[model samples]
Target: MNSHLLNGHYQILKLLNDREDGKTYLVEDVNFPDSQFIVKQLRPPSSNPQTLTILRRLFASKAATLEKLGQKNDKIQKLIAYFEENEEFYIVQEFISGNPLTDEIIQGQPLSEDQVITLLLEILEILVIVHSYGVIHRDIKPANIIRRESDKKLALVNVGTFNEAITNTVDNLEYMPIEQVNGNLKYNSDIYALGMVAIAALKGLPAKEISNLRSQKNQLTGEIVWDNKNLKVNRKLAKIINRMVRFDYRKRYQYATEVLNDLKKLINVEDDQQKQHHKKLLLVLTGVVGCIILGVGAWQLRSPKPGSDAELKLYQEGVNKYDAGNYEGAVEDFNQAIKLDPQNALAYNKRGDAYYRLGDYEQAQADSSQALLLNPQDANAYFDRGFAFSQLGKYKEAIADYNQAIKLNSKNGYAYYGRGLALAQLKDNKGAIRDFSKAIALKPRYTEAYLQRGIVRRRLKLRQAAIQDFDTVIKIDPSDAKAYYQRGLTQSINKQKYVALKDYTEAININPKYIEAYLNRGDLYSDLGDNVEATENYNTILKIDPKFIPAYIHRAIHRFSFGNYQGAIEDYTTALKLDPNNITAYNNRGNAYLELGNKKAANQDYSQAIAINPNNALAYYNRGVIRSKQKNKQGAIADFQKAAKLFQQQGEQDSYQDAQKEIAILQHNLAPAPTTRPKSNNY
Candidate 1:
């Protein structure tokens, strides 16, 4: 069909989309040439008069609601008019000069956590007003949300309530909550739709695809496996979004206002955290000082005081400097305080902390030991000493000191956290997890503990639990790029390729200098058979970190797979330059050389590999083949014998047999060939 005028006033400029239910078009108003608008033509299910009457009533009601809604909110698209043309309904809405949310979304890729939050906040702000008017945006998907180019603000378009009158309206099924299908549409149903939209945009996948990615299914809990796809979402924001999209509408936010209120709280919390960071540091110093005083023994009141006024003043200054991140200055102040009052344990402990911050584990340990000597039961000194030991790679000593600290103060979260790190270093994952759990119980917002525990969980192959842990870290600190990157690793291992890719992308988006994220993303792209995209990612990695050996090796492998022998050789050579002792690199480079018919070069690489690892049967076999081709029968036989012995020792029976056959062929060739040629001529 051709583009035509709608209602003899709006001329269809082009068809925007053609769906089962209707056709959406960009149009110009003939009455006002400067005005551009969207015209949607919908056909009722049937030509029956009764159906037409019901459709007309529903359309008229929705149009009127839109016009009023648009009048109240600039973010909502304005309804200009609606009319019946022939037997179809034509609705005109103000055109928005922007791209749909889906336009920037690449399937299996994700937007940054902050970007997604910003999008949700803008959409929810508008939804709060729409829901207050008892309107449910029956359709909430990426395509329905326009991100305006002018102000970069998101606009909610195509507002229509799908109640009993339009219950059968075809819509994006992926975004539809269960309640909508059950005809139990509530205001929260819109919240569910919005949550799905966020998920779709974050995963760079459509709602339908996201819906299928759900691995957790229960009456009260419906969570997609891709929910933690490496986006460092704030914990509160993640929880809020999860609740918003609950399968049971009753579990979701009952009103858009409810979600808006929570988002407002998140915004305020984030703003306060950003704006009052210095204030928080001062508060921390004050709190730590108060704790130290309260925890001191009655010996402090004895004559010839443990600390003089001058010492106390210097100690306080040291603490202030420490809080301000001036570790060297803090250390100097602590030294002066200690000189003035040798018995001041707090001064020694604070100095130890400054030393630790400066990466001087030796001085930190000495200061902490002196603090412990002055105050035998000081938990802070034990904890500080434990931290120093842990940093020095003395896991056993760290564990011992952490135990002492915990014994002195059972509620010390840092002690437990420190013990957990020590245990992790010792490969005691269970012990580490217990300590981490204790730390988390004492401090609910312990991001480091959560991150470490997540890493341990991943190591233990408790992948789902690991994901939950990373999710918590993200919630506590949305800007934790490492959390997102780690979560992506788990997702990749879980075989969620696209979801893993999205997570890696989110990590890179948060931290542009994240080389590992780029490498993982490139690998995922290669596995997905998009070599071009994969090469681009590898190129990006090289651009960011040219000295990265793995990038060169991986790109070389990629080049080799596609018959690019020269490129593969170049990459392999670069990788070898970065890591000269890499056995795999030498072997791979040899193979690439062999492919290019550089037998002498191939022989040198194979010899180098064998020299590095004499048990490398494959390398010996390769060298034997090259020697045989060069007519060096004796050298070929020696190499084959070595290859056979090594392969047999390594339990590679087939390889061992191949090497034996090659040896036998060489031996046969070395024996009475003249007699065999005479017998063949006689025959």
Candidate 2:
């Protein structure tokens, strides 16, 4: 099937392997050659249509299992698609291009102690998820573990599903646990294999030879001794490995995380010991105070301490670079500062802030964590880490850090503001308002806090209070386009259309590139029945930034309201091209297709939207309407029930009630329900 296109997209480039079961091909997208995939084809015993149908069902069932596993772990190769074509089944998955561990672990040429530790840790990380899923990778050997070429991350491939069981273990005797050979595979079975791999590396031999070495076996138990006196390995690591490869499966680590924790502890202990040794040596060598009193002019240098002069110089340079927006340069200077004085908490805190600016939240979190370790009471370090956590979507952790910062310094307006943001994400609007109000009390002219509080009030239906917050912000800084735009939103909600139009106009005039202001102005004009002006506003936003998605969505919504269904479809289509997973565009376009009576396309769009965001109540409700039209009563009721449940969970009481009404109608009256237009493009 070379060069044959499958799924209307993937074209087979080259056959990777041909086995008794099927053939595996390296395929690339017809439109994008660089987007590569591996397609596995399953061949039946004969071309009987019934047998082929059964084979197709089996392929799809197993594919679903692999797909679910793919979503829960980043270290596992992803299952992209599974389909049937020309009476053959195809399973497409992400192609991980890398050599196996066998290439790196040459027999008789052992890896360094650190190298082996790193490999064990990386593989164990992947196994942690695999084991958590209650699945055992019966085959855990060097050849099966791929070290990714791009990032050097170990990605586990060829996972055996329940349908495609891996029963063969004759050649992998060295890596297979004894219990696994007897069909009793525990989670720690993989741990035994990994430990054997480590032992093989330490002994400078292949795992097969190490497993069968009679000389290394215990005198009575027949268990192979793992560590050797000649092997250069840490005592702690050796002990951990011994427990991992215990002859009794029950004696080994019961979980991968247990082993991971122990390995991390060993690393931490080694680091602390090295640091202590260096500190003691420095103290002995830098005792120059007595020499200076004895008139020994040769003793000119002294021991470095926290915030030493050299470190301070580098720290100041880092601060200047950070202020100038040279985050990478600031990080370099801070690295030097920390190297010169390892205990410089100020340097670490500043570096964390710089990393935050550079959009490296993980590094920012790490540096801030180190700063907190050195100076536990540092409020700024807590705030910095909290800010990083907020960006990383760890809202609860961010709130805890912000709470600590506020406890250390109650006057810190930034802490209150950050805590408010985290609370808002967690849907605690009242708590967010309280924090925002506290922030405003601490800094009366804080525009961001006022703006956020105004938005929250608007969401809570306190339009007048929200308007007042916007007014205060505008009064403080008249040139603030965002404040004027927010005020316009409140005014629009309060039915002051003309006043809202003027506010949007002022916002646009102040910031000529304000896309949201343009969209809102367009919406206001549309509400006023000024079609030409509304279209012009949306067109202006598109002209400013052709790739801006909101402009297309707003224009589509405007066209739909004016009964221009085809124009709306065109705009939604363009928006989807810019962002394939734009749930708003997909759902709205589905509505347009439904209006045009293209039920198939509409169903497809709704299904795609639901696939992208499973909690999409609107998509489910709309699909229910279609199913009702098609006289699928049971399917319609099921969809309506699911939609109602999701709507209730999402706090859309009106939509939830509508969905319940649909289900009742479908169940009793058998009448088709009206379609809903959800606030898909809320902005």
Clashes of each: 2, 0
Give the candidate number with the greatest lDDT.
Answer: 2
> What global local distance difference test value does model 1 have?
0.78
Write out the backbone clash pairs for model 2.
none
> What's the distance in Å from true for residue 155, model 2?
67
Local accuracy of candidate 2 as per-residue lDDT tens digits, 1-683: 65567889998889888877678889998888789998877665668878666666666676777787798566787899888777767778898989988787777898888888888888876776566455677667777788899998888886655223311223367777788778777878889888888877776676557556525779797677756677768877888998988889988887776787688767766764464355345433443444556665443223345557787788778866765558999999999988887876667877898899899999999999997776566677899999999999999999999999999889889899999999999989999999999999999989899999999999999999999999999765555678889999999988999999988986775556789999999988987888999999999999999999999998898898899999999999999999999988988898899889998898899899889999888888888887788888898888889999998998989889998888878778755644444334443
Query: Each model's TM-score?
Result: 0.52, 0.51
lDDT of 1 by residue, 368-395 (tens): 9986775565677788899899989999
The C-alpha stretches of model 1 lying farther than 4 A from their native spots are 1-314, 475-477, 609-683
Native-vs-model 2 lDDT?
0.80
Residue-level lDDT for 49 in candidate 2: 77
